[model samples]
Target: MAGEYGLKRYFDADAARLLGGRIRAVQPGFDVEGYAAEVDSRIPGKELKDRVLVLAEGLRTRLPADYADAVPVLLAILGDELAEGEGMFTNSWFLMPVARFVEEYGLDHPDLSLDAIEEITKRHTGEYAIRPYVEQHYAPTMERVAHWARSPSHHVRRLASEGIRSHLPWARTLTMFVEDPRPVLEILEPLRSDGSEYVRRSVANNLNDISKDAPGLALATALRWMEESPTPETGRIVTHGLRTLVKKGDQQALALLGATGGEHVRVPRLSLTPGSVAVGDTLLIGFDIENTDGRAHRVAVDYVVHHVRKNGRSTPKVFKLATLELGPGERRSLEKSHAIREVRTRRYYAGEHTVDIQVNGLVRATGRFDLRT
Candidate 1:
């Protein structure tokens, strides 16, 4: 039988052998067998991030004890920069541990480590690895990151935005940026209309993270970006960046996205088909919305699934449904199916669940369903 699917499988013995072999090629004195064995022994039963750390630790043991001395070897083994807008994870996943090694061991050597991270990110990703430097060596790192924002390589440019995200996934939160995002905003300025969509998307995500903490600031920034550029690309970045605020129905956010006149829409009927479902079943939700206003209006329709938690309390998750314009007296019917399936991120509890039809951030109608264990 095939083994269960997991991220850890990606960093198993074979990956260690590959990484060890690369290190051996660069530093002929490197002990490939011992390094591979150490990673193989420590990796079993560890989670994905932990497994990467294990590989990093193996490198620590085999590489030269001095961080400065080790820098040249790591750089020599980086191979080549990924093609523009490619290889965040697909191209060189093995380099994750190499980046991690720089993160864990290269802190005291900010310039060297930053240089290494810049090169590593070109091939794989230094997003996770660069966080500590931002934390420990704030001024210098941000200065370097600002310079990277203008790099010729899209990968390096993306690192400028992605590396400084306040809540980058799989990485520690940058609380300093969360509290005061001015620095991050400055770094993102040049990247607003970057040539690469890959880089632009990171800028949007970074703005999204900023929105979570400082909605007003995020809104203001989005508005300014729109006013300054007003290009389709800038519009996409602003819309995605303000998604959380838009979901919460922030008036300015909705207005910026042209999802206005929510109050003039009426949901005459909302139905959840077969109101009860067990895990792994699909539930169809249908609703009819009519424009009550005499003038045409843009509508941003969304749904909220208030999932029952293990404690019996519920938390709301907003899902995007549709965005359309309705003329005077126009009516539209929309349907969406939601599958209640097992996933790593969430657990479903058997109980009553609530669904709300949200238009332009305002809840127009609500319904309920029972979930069976």
Candidate 2:
């Protein structure tokens, strides 16, 4: 059914007509039918993002040729700011094409574009559109972004962090920030204790992106945030930001989260029900952990699945299991069911797969399952 689902369907002919009508309402003598035809002709078979680009291109041809002249027309169509907790997909879905228009055409007009981005982000997202400005006009753009980091609107504040992510998904990577994340970190400083979880989550994701390239920097930043601002918000940010490092069993990261003394724990058994399964079947994993240390220990339990590749080699994927505080000699039983199904991100292969029980950063037990195609 996922294959059956197409995001481009939302931008079908009817959407073109609605957008055309909106443009006509704001600017008399606008060629509504011509705009609709332009978008409708090229949209079929195009993907979601491509469909959005088609709409943007249609606007570029139909609207005023000058970037500054076109901005007011584009802004006039933005209805209102999205309510708190409202996503861009629902009410502001039409703005996707509009945002893309700015990204494609508004580079030389930074002041106009940035102003439009600020207004557009309140209703939709300026995250993707703001990237070009950050890339082309680094200093002044980031100055405005820093100002946005303190904006009253959480959406704008979120953009301040989300726009400059080193590896923002669906957008080109910001290599400048990836090479040196100090500037991005400075912008994230004030937002560490932001009241909005939405903004804080973006801050976490930005740090997570940084961690992939600059682990030490991310770790030091997380530790500093924990020391300076010990709020629940910052704690979540640090925990999420250091997730990749923790999964790799980075001892310093484990210790920072109090998941220490992992080597002192013992997993008496790791069992797999239905040791063999087909692609659509479910595999049940059961394990018991005992804290063998003399003192109480905080445990971060995880499981690793070594999936079979086309070449018969195995690639390990980590899945979080549990986090608990265990008194000395305390024992706990845990059960997890994993469904082997079809998805876009990964393909399933038939072979023997190894599963490991990892306590903190240490592997305590291992088991195997045979997958049949």
Candidate 3:
């Protein structure tokens, strides 16, 4: 293949050794001549596709029923071999087969405990690309995480985050954590102030994941730790974990940062134009603020939209607007736009809907609206 694509010289020693050995042992029938011819014919500007295709073809022919069992050794060695210079692994096309193998193998292994699962997942996470297996096996995977939390290996500790990250690199979204993050939090709480920066970073990311689903929960938990007189290091860890959400209008989140809602910031006039907007309509939210404090300050805006479910439970969805930088006695005008859309899991009714703009994590402005069909 390299010869055909004019990439014969580009075949590094590692690639040539592995691909050559596999060819000689597994497929004496393999067409080295055909591969060379194809490589010679390969054009420039198609390096990525051509290289990936060659790897995929090799994987498809060699993958076996017991592939999952062999994956750890292969990945431990080969994954580092395949990783890019920046330390990030690429999702080669052969990833799905590995996922399928684990899925199939795991189904019959009901007795597999957390520790065993971690051994496989840690090895294959970025190499065999076993994210689907990780997501599908979250319960056991998390149990493994709890066990690993006590391990002495930083490598294993890092896996705790790499495995369950909502946005794990080049992997599927782990939405289960988005709704209920308790299990993941359990694994992270003990490691929040880990002596290793590597482990601490993972704990911070796990907290960040929780912020997406329940910002208040994340903030409250941080507050609970703070109230317990967290060590300075733990305080820093919690603060870093909440950095994004606090900047994004988690009121309780900012409170952890020492922002006083009512003392330094005040809203004299706050309004929303066309207080009512239906699906496919735009809601223009405006906030007018006054900084009464003697010094300059940055006040963030938070919006809580009252969403009434079909079951009559009203839930508040909060969003953060721009950061308003105000000078002493200065007034500001800020506008935000939101497009209303139908809720997939819930329905909205035509009624007096409520919207409020909060300043410094405090509700300083509010208005009412109607959602018509």
Candidate 4:
């Protein structure tokens, strides 16, 4: 996998060449080869993430000592707006090292870091780059971030929510936000109904990250957002934000989303077709659900397959079927076909596998299937 383009050529000599040319275009006196050489020398065999800082280190060594001056040169080379279509984020890879350098050295003059990041994000993203800055200067830094939530550019608004994620992937976590996310939530609240799907997704992802460790706060926020004013965009945001807890069959999350409250629901018929399957084959599971209560009930029907692993053990994986409201004394029939195949993330072993049907968050029926290579 490391031999593939995602990592193998991401920071190779060719990348350095283009990056140097761009920088040299902005600052004619800039040393291009020196920067490229350092990038290449330190980049081979290293993963892409390691190369980002290495590129930043190269810039540190070869660029002007004045961070303010050097930043403008980088900014000048960046396009005025994010690229459209194929090469998106490609041009911005250069910004990673630029932001990394600022993360480490811009503590003394925090305003410069703020300025550089705000400008840089328009052409790419400062989400990962701004984490350390926020961690170091929480009060002043987030004040600016909170202001960014209202910016004209959705990209800037996204940075406002993204940079403050407690568990941002490929970036350091904001520990303060992890402990107390009020400030970050304050930034996100206004943007819940943001017009752009891009910004909305980031806001939702931020909430989802918060949900992992602070489910109550996340649920409260989602419920409030939905109850107060849930636009199509905001509705999508809440749905995605609650996705993790829903997958885990969290009863509170289920109930909050109106996908629960099925105390009188029953699965009278549940079975796997043929009761046997082979690796690389497909299995169909069918079920009949009845609502017995004298009131309407929302049911989130899910199925769990206990997969057999090579170590002679099994792990349960949940698959969502449907979320439909059922009237009193009503019955609904549903079926789903699941494929068992060799996947990069899982290895299948021959064994008897168990399956269960869940209503709301409760498992209501169980069945079994055999799997063989």
Clashes (N, CA, C under 3 Å) per candidate:
0, 0, 15, 0
Scored by Cα lDDT, where does model 1 land? 0.89
Q: Which parts of model 3 have CA positions greater than 4 angstroms off?
A: 1-57, 63-65, 72-130, 167-169, 261-373
Cα RMSD (Å) per model?
2.2, 2.2, 10.4, 3.7
lDDT of 1 by residue, 20-54 (tens): 88888888888887877887788878888899899
- Alpha-carbon lDDT, every model: 0.89, 0.89, 0.59, 0.81
lDDT of 2 by residue, 1-373 (tens): 0231444578866777788889999989888788888777898888777888998888899888888898999899999898778878777877888899999999988999999999999999999999989989999999999999999999999999999998987788999988999999999999988999999999999999999999999999999999998878788898898888888888888898778778889999889989999989999999899999888999899999999999999999999888989999899999999999877567889999999999887889999999999
What does candidate 4's lDDT look like per residue over 283-347, in tens digits? 99988999998888888888998998778889999888888899989998899999988764678
Q: In model 2, which runs have C-alpha deviations exceeding 4 angstroms?
A: 1-9, 29-37
Flag regions of model 1 displaced more than 4 Å: 1-5
> By descending lDDT, how would the candidates be arranged?
1, 2, 4, 3
Worst 10-residue stretch by lDDT in candidate 3?
81-90
Residue-wise C-alpha lDDT for candidate 3, range 1-373, written one tens digit per residue: 2122333234333443444344545435555444444434542344433444454344434443464454442333323322212222223222322333343444445334233334443433321233455566656655666777776656566667656776554345777777677777777766776777766776777677678777878888887767775688777778678867764556667667665534577777767768667878988877778888888776666788888666666778777665666788888777788778764444677777788777766777778777776
Better of 3 and 4 by lDDT: 4
Model 1 residue 209 CA deviation (Å) reads 0.8
Q: What is the lDDT of candidate 3?
A: 0.59
